[model samples]
Target: MAALALRGFGRRCLLARLGPGPALHQTIPMATTAQEEMRRFWERNSRSGRPVSPHVSIYKWSLPMAMSISHRGTGVALSLGVSLFSVAALLLPESFPHYLAQVRALSLGPALLCSAKFLLALPLCYHSWNGVRHLAWDLGKGLRLPQVTQSGLLVLALTLLSSAALAAL
Candidate 1:
């Protein structure tokens, strides 16, 4: 009886191991599917002969656009200038006036000196005036097309005048 029981158990274990436990299938490739979708999207949206969107080359230039770009540029320039100046002040010996005096001692030509001064002053003036213009716009002023154009002009004029005065000094 014991021998029969052992033989039956062994046969059951062998049948279980040989039976189909789970079904296995190959995975669908996802990367190929994604690439195909992207290609189809681009093909649908692309223009045949003409450009799809208006580029910088297609748009006409205007003063307001120029001023807007300048305002952003000046803001970045002023921020960078102030950061560098602060770092120099902390690292260099002596004080700010010492550097100024050293530059003065160089005896640089007036034209070149004034030009350097203008370059330094222009960004500050432009950023400040443009900041004021932004504030005015925030206050619900200069919303109209004409007002926007006039305010842009005023900002440029103020920037030039302030830069000139500072450079002269």
Candidate 2:
């Protein structure tokens, strides 16, 4: 017990000589708010000529990179489209068949209808095909640069073919 007490006293002496911890806090100021902290960060980066975040302008465009970005965009678009369609279906007073008949009553030209169908299918088909490409990557395939480019091209072609076929229906 005496040795332990002596050790504790020595530690206190060492801590006092170091003049850190609570002592350091007295000399170093701290930002009070997140905004002030961010301001300090930006000021430091500005003075150092360092970018605080990455910008798309610095990246060179590539097939796989573009395909990945579009895949996300299409996925979001399809999800939003489905969600809006479901909400409209639930909230609208008219029944599905009633709206169908109303649309049919317009006697719209086939060309315009086909165009609308194609537009509707574009995102869906692209998302589906690109999703398959992503799955292939998950399976440890098409990892190389050339393979990625080829698969991206193939996905685009398949999307076009499938969209065209479905729209023709």
Per-model clash counts, in order, read: 0, 0
lDDT string for model 2 (1-169, tens) is: 9999999999999988887776657676563789988888889989998665566456688888888899999999989989999999999999899999999999989999988889999999999999998899999999998999999999999999999899999
What ranges in model 1 sit over 4 Å off? 1-32, 47-61
Clashing pairs in 2: none
lDDT, each prediction: 0.86, 0.90
Which structure among the candidates has the greatest TM-score? 1
> Which residue pairs in model 1 clash with each other?
none
TM values, all candidates = 0.72, 0.68
lDDT of 1 by residue, 120-140 (tens): 899899989988999999999
What shift in Å separates residue 58 of candidate 1 from its native position after superposition? 6.5
* RMSD in order of candidates: 9.5, 9.2
Q: Which parts of model 2 are misplaced by more than 4 Å?
A: 1-57
